[model samples]
Target chain A: MGATEMREPSFLILTALAGGPLHGYAVIAEVAQMSQGRVRLRAGTLYAALERLAAEGLVASSGEQVVDGRLRRYFRLTDEGEQALTLEARRLRENADRAVARLRTARSRVAPA
Target chain B: MTAGPEAAYRRLLRAYPASWRRRHADAVLGTLLDQADAEGRSAVSVADVRDILGHGLLARLHLLLDVVPGRVRAVAGTAALGSGAGLCLALLLLGEWLPPWAPPSTREAGFGPFLTVGPLLYAAWLLAVAASLLRHPRLARSLLGAATLAAVVLPHVVANAYPYAGVERPSSTALAPLAVLGLLVLAAPPSRPSPAVVAATAIGTVAAVGGPMLPLWLSGGSPFPVRDFFYYAYAHHLAVSAAVLLAAGLLAAVAALVARRPAYAGGALLALLPWAVLLLAVWRRISTQGMSALEPLVVVAGVGAALAVLGGLRALGVRVRL
Candidate 1:
């Protein structure tokens, strides 16, 4: 059966956690801010990503603590995670640069401006 | 307790397996309640329900995949390797591969169907098993498959062409050789998705253990007619049983390569213990009589027991490299 997929919001999630370890709700809020309110990660979507990331060794549990009378489990990026995120960031930047360069060439050719 | 956001979300949280819920439910519930508080809401949203149910089932599937094929098939592969090797050893020990007891026609020169097929398949299996041990599993698999196909065709060649052997119609493709063919196929491992590997392993195992005994079953618990090829006596019974234990150890070793702990091997050994004992217990009688009715049942039971033991280990927080 074809699986219904949640679009991977791992980049923004990793970017949010890059600053430090954060609990589930704090991550949701941080990702919202990081994405400039463009990629809103719901609780279900966030946990699913976190679970997959944890399984893949890209994320790990930092600790659990009590915050505001509720238990909050904190997650941190591992060294491997940092490496993966760095590689992805570099790749994405390279592609963006290439695209931008191509667009300038196209613009110059179209109107000679 | 009251019908509020926490209560409603708690109901939604039931979608996850109990173990998963235990680990992550409190955090997830906390997050959901926090989201609800920020939105000034008291009821669950449609999107929340959809994601929860969907991801919950997905998580359960992931958990099942981790336990089932991951360890069991690896163990089965090892066990099958043992069985394949054990069969070769048994044949040599019993003098069945060119058995001295056979009439002169069944000798190496005569090339009676089993005489030729048994040694060839077992030799290929031994080589494949060696290759697999050396971490050349892909090469081993190719050799094993080629050997099995060759074994399948050889019976016809030896039986039909070699009329000088004096046996009018040879059932070389019948029981024991078929089992060995099955072993070679099984020990080879399949195209290597865990499920496919497991299925191929299961079929090979049935053929290895049951293929030989099917003739005995048909013959109404009397000695089968084809003694020149494979002597279905004490040697055969002992070999089959030994194969079970040896193969169990082999797969467990493969698992240990991933687990890196001797305890993983111990788990597989413990699983096969009953089956080995059962076969040993009945083999003497089987050698004297036709075939033990319990042989097939014993094999299936042994495998089930092994899968259960490993699966239980997985549930108990013993992690494998899957």
Candidate 2:
């Protein structure tokens, strides 16, 4: 229940790429949209996270493309990235389950018997 | 219309080092342009600019360390070995052939209570330096810290650690240089200094510093310290240590230039500093009323400062093939 090392933006980016490869802007927009646009991303922040993730072998550049008369470098999750995402998801689920079970126990204790 | 997003983002990317830019520019610029296009950004935002600028400069600093072998540990480790050798030599000089130079009521003192504590400190300190050279940073740091504490504090614990009669217990202050050296090693990040670099720094300092000691020893006896011009033999030896220290340090710097190892040069400066302090203490032993204390300290300090700057200049991007 403790894989909190990955920041929310990084987790979102990795999750966005899990569906397949996406270019830089697509990943940014997808992350923002996934978080209901509450997590807007700047280009610089995205690159920094991408570089860190790439260095950690969690994400990598799949290839490049020329999109709408501009360069688009696509990124995808690696096997390691998928494993990390899986672990984080599991941890999050475990934590949520524990919280829900504890709340249900407390509510039942206070309910009429 | 103002400069497009491409131009603005390209400008921000310039904060990174030339090497990083050369490798990542096109790809990174591509991403920036794509982001700007998709976001419908007419201009760069403050947060975007800040992020790029910060990371760019951070990359530059990392590249600088990568390019230069002159990491802070280079100086500290080299200083550790060099000073260790120099200290041994100075101790030998003091231990032998200089007892007559000792004043009354003190010549009979055999390091007083220091003998018990000094050996352990030396052994541990030597091991720390070895650990540093062996690339065991954690062990080296722990040992160095322990040695520093022992050097700085243990002398005071053992009463009359100095050969001087109770009239003079300079052991605590005397070991200050060793403590400083230890602290330097402990404080710095362990850089990758090849064994060759370490050996060269240690051996070169010894050979250079030892050359003068032979003649002085062979001459049969050390001359008394002179406060006046040309009358004192001790004064010449005093200058001898500092001069050779400077020469050895600069020579090491030059050798590092040849080898493209900036760390060796920095180590030389570190080695020079403690020896300078030891030399001052040696001077104080024989220094008479005629000599101004400030005079020799200034001279020694000037030499030390110059050599230190020479070593540190590598970090300033002076480009000693780093």
Reference-based lDDT, each prediction: 0.59, 0.62
Model 1 CA deviation exceeding 4 Å by range: A1-8, B1-3, B69-322
State how far residue A9 of model 1 sits from its true place (Å): 0.9
The digit string of per-residue lDDT tens for model 2 on B1-322 reads 2357778788888898887788677777777766665667778877778888888887776565544344644565556654654554443443232333333332344444222335456656667667766666667667667767877776566565223333222254346667766655554544444566556555654565455555554443323211111123344454455556656666666677678765555555555566566556555544553566556664666566655655466554545444
The CAPRI class of candidate 1 is acceptable
Lowest summed lDDT across 10 adjacent residues in model 2 chain B is found at: B222-231
Number of the predicted model whose TM-score against the real structure is largest: 2
Candidate 2 lDDT over A8-97, as tens digits, reads 898899999999999877888899889998998776678778988998899998888775556678899999999999998877789899
The residue-by-residue lDDT of candidate 1 on B115-181, one tens digit each, is: 3335655667677766765556577777677665665565566554433343332233232343443
Model 1: per-residue Cα lDDT at residue B312: 51
**Which candidate wins on lDDT?**
2
As for candidate 2, its clashing pairs are: none
Checking candidate 1 for backbone clashes, the offending pairs are B78-B250, B78-B251, B79-B247, B79-B248, B82-B247
Off by over 4 Å in 2: A1-4, A110-113, B1-3, B67-321
